[model samples]
Target: MLYPIFEYFDQVLDIPGTGVFRYISFRAGMAALVSLIITITFGKNIINWIRNKQIGETVRDLGLEGQNEKKGTPTMGGLMIMAGIIIPTLLFANINNIYIILLLITTVWLGGIGFLDDYIKVFRKNKEGLAGRFKIIGQIVIGIVVGATLYFHEGVVVREFTNPVSIEQGMVETPAFKDVKTMKTTIPFMKDNELNYEKIFGFLGDSATPIFYILIVIFIVTAVSNGANITDGIDGLAAGTSAIIGLTIAIFAYISGNAIFSQYLNVFFIPNSGELVIFCAAFVGACVGFLWYNSYPAQVFMGDTGSLMLGGVIAVLSFALRKELLIPVLCGIFVIENASVIIQVSYFKYTKKKYGEGRRVFLMSPLHHHYQKKNIHEAKIVTRFWILGILLAIITLATLKLR
Candidate 1:
């Protein structure tokens, strides 16, 4: 919202300070600071309002230590995060950018779905919430929209150079470069790192490639969003881990959007993707600030609203940066949390079918609860997982040069 006005003032009116708004770094910093301030300042009031309204989490009896204590805490605090992200993006980012537009849409779309789910659970008095099938449908719809837009939008294109450039010198002046639209994504730890959808769907022909790509998008959006929801099982786990992932992606966005950095790293230079840095900045700040109230002895829970939206935003950001393949590493915490439940359920069913009795893999599902069953403190479990998340993020970044 503010971007264009300041730009006009700087360009047309020759205002000195207004030109500073043109810098992505400056805008990103402001977005992060403003986002932090908004969440921290408004979080207390929102929590109190929800508490007074008696809108609290309905925690199932998991039989874990300290589980019952969280039963009636104020919930659906993700609205704070939504405001933090959207407000900053609108105020500091160029709203006209395609990347920004898609991000804003994603925040609202998935947030709305999550909010509805929370509403059903809290106000409607239905523990089943929005139904699993309905959630899946919502995810699929957004996935199709995001995939189709990225595939068909004229603004979404990657720059390819005709000549080889040395990564050491990092020359911006290349022999020639062309901005072309292709379903190509980055592959980690490979000398030739680009993976094109055309090659994968060669047998299906060029006409069928987009259909397959969109299917992939649908799967990714569903999987990651669900993964995030599951990871929200404990306080500070989801928000803290997501903040780390957001910061890492923000770094990637800044580098991918810069020609010099892209050339230096020998990576794909996505035109106009730099604007995503501002969005990511707000994302990270929101998550971190929410931690003030969401930590160990939590004051509020993000529930489905924050969890699903966080994962969806991350998924879209990865695709926008052409780094979707890196999700497994960068989002290792979410992946493992999701995997624990899948493994436990599959093992239990298989054991029951074979032995006429269900056997458990972990003491409880979703890794964190298993640790809780081991008599580990929730705070300790969260901190350990965060450390692992940081390690995974470092490895993910290292892949930029390891390739």
Candidate 2:
């Protein structure tokens, strides 16, 4: 909204200092500041409203220390996060950018799905909120939309040289480059890091490539979203980890969108994706701001609303920045948390079938809960997990040069 107004001010009105808004870094900083202000300042009021409406968390007796104390805390504080991200983006980002459009849609789409799940749990008194199948379907729908848009949109193109150009080839001088739409994505830790989807799906013929790409997109969106949801078991785990991941993605967006940096780093150069840096800035700020109340001894919980949206947006940004392949490393915490659950469930089923007695892997399912089961304080577990998340983030950033 404000992008065009600032443009008019700089161009038509010739307003002094208005030209600063033309810089992505300036706008991104403003967006992050605004998001932090909104989430922190108005968060209390939103929490009060939710609490007044009797929208609180209902904790099951999980036999974990201090678990019962969390019951009745205001839930659905994700409203604050959503407002923090959307309002700032509208005010500071180019709303017409297709990448921005898809991100906004993903935020609303996944947020709405999570809201419904929380609503069912709180209002309808159904512990099993929103059938699992339905949630997967919603995720698949958004994945298809994002995948199809990136696949078909003309504006979504990567800059490629007619002759193979590399850092070794000397990018000090401008080289002939053309923007073309393709299914190539960045694969970390390889010298020639680009992976074309055609190499894997070409056997099915050209027409089937889009289908396979969309299917991969759907899988990523669903997996990460569910990973975050399950990781939300402990306070500050999801939001804090998400903040780290978002910052890493924002760096990728900035580097990929800048031609000079892309050439120097030998990374995929995506046109017009710099706008995503602003979106990701808002995301990181919102998560950090929410952590104020979402941390240990929380006053409010983000519930599924914030968790699902965070994961979905991260997945979409990775795709937009061509860094989707780095998700396993960057999102290692979410992956491990998700894997713990799957491993436990699978192992339990196998043991039950063979020995007619259920066996356990960890003391509990998700890794955090296992720590809690080991008598580790939730705050200590959260802190350790956050430290691990930071380490993973650094590794993720190192991929920009490590390859």
Candidate 3:
């Protein structure tokens, strides 16, 4: 909102300082600083409120050391993270931009789902809080909305280019306007890196292209969001890992959005995507600040309030930037956590069919608890996971050049 005011002041009133807001980096930095301030300041007040209302996390005897001791620590501090991200974005970003609008919507929409689940568990005393079906429904609804808009929205498009082995080629420049195309996204470890979903139904010609392409995006959105949600089982694990992933994505978004950088790299140059940097900056700030209270011996649990939104935001941002394929690598932690659950359950069902009881796979699912059960300190586990997240982030960045 303040963007326009800064523009007016800079251009019309000739205010010297207002022009700095024009730079994406400047706005991104401002957003991060603002998010940090909001989290650190309001975090304490919310903690007190949660404690006053006895809105503490109910811990079953998880059998881990210091597990039950955290039974009454505050919960739902994700509200602080939400506020931190939203307010900064509104203040520092171009609110009219479609990407920003979609991000804000996803942030609030999935966040509301998580907050409701947390509320049900805390207030209604329902251990099952918002049935799994409902959560799936909410995620699917979001996926559909995001998928439809991304496919149908005219403002959303990518400017692709070609490379040459024999000679340097000029960018397709006819109308001085770049190619605004809606199709499949990029795939890693490939030569050309392009993978259009429309190709799935080439037999039907142009008619089936839109049908299959939209479904592909919807599937990707749902899968990534749920993957991140389930990965939130341990304190500071998801947040810490998400921060690292967000930083890498933020770098990719920066280069992808900048016309010159994208051309130099011979990659898709998405106009208006630079604005995403500010949103990601806010994301990193919110996650880091939440980590202050979310660290081992956590003062508060983010619950579904933080987890679902975090995952959704990551998914949407990756999709928006055509980096969804990088999720398995960038979000390796979430991917492993997700796969562990799938494997554990699938094996249990298989074993139960053959034997009398369901058997176990790692001490527990979600992967983190497996180590937690082996007397691994929560802090140590979280730290190592963060290291792995960093490792994955670096590997993901290398993909931009490796191919």
Best by lDDT: 1
Q: In model 3, which runs have C-alpha deviations exceeding 4 angstroms?
A: 160-175, 205-207
Tell me the lDDT of model 3 at 372. 87
Tell me the whole-model lDDT of each prediction, alpha carbons only. 0.93, 0.93, 0.85
lDDT of 1 by residue, 1-403 (tens): 9999998999999988999998999999999999999999999999999999899999889898998899899999999999999999999998999999998998999999999999999999999999999999999999999999999999999988787544556644455778998889999999999999888996887678889889999999889999999999888999999999999999999999987789889888999999999999999999999999999899999988899999999999999999999999999999998999999999999999999999998999899999999999999999999999999999999999997
Off by over 4 Å in 2: 161-176
Quote model 3's TM-score.
0.94
Candidate 3 local lDDT, residue 250: 90
Cα RMSD to the true fold for all candidates:
2.0, 2.4, 3.2
Q: List the residue pairs that clash in candidate 3.
A: none
Candidate 2 per-residue C-alpha lDDT over 208-250 given as tens digits, one digit per residue, 9 for 90 to 100: 8899999999999999999999999888989999999999899
What's the CA error at residue 89 for candidate 1, in Å? 0.4
- TM-score computed on alpha carbons, candidate 2: 0.97
lDDT for model 1, on a 0 to 1 scale?
0.93
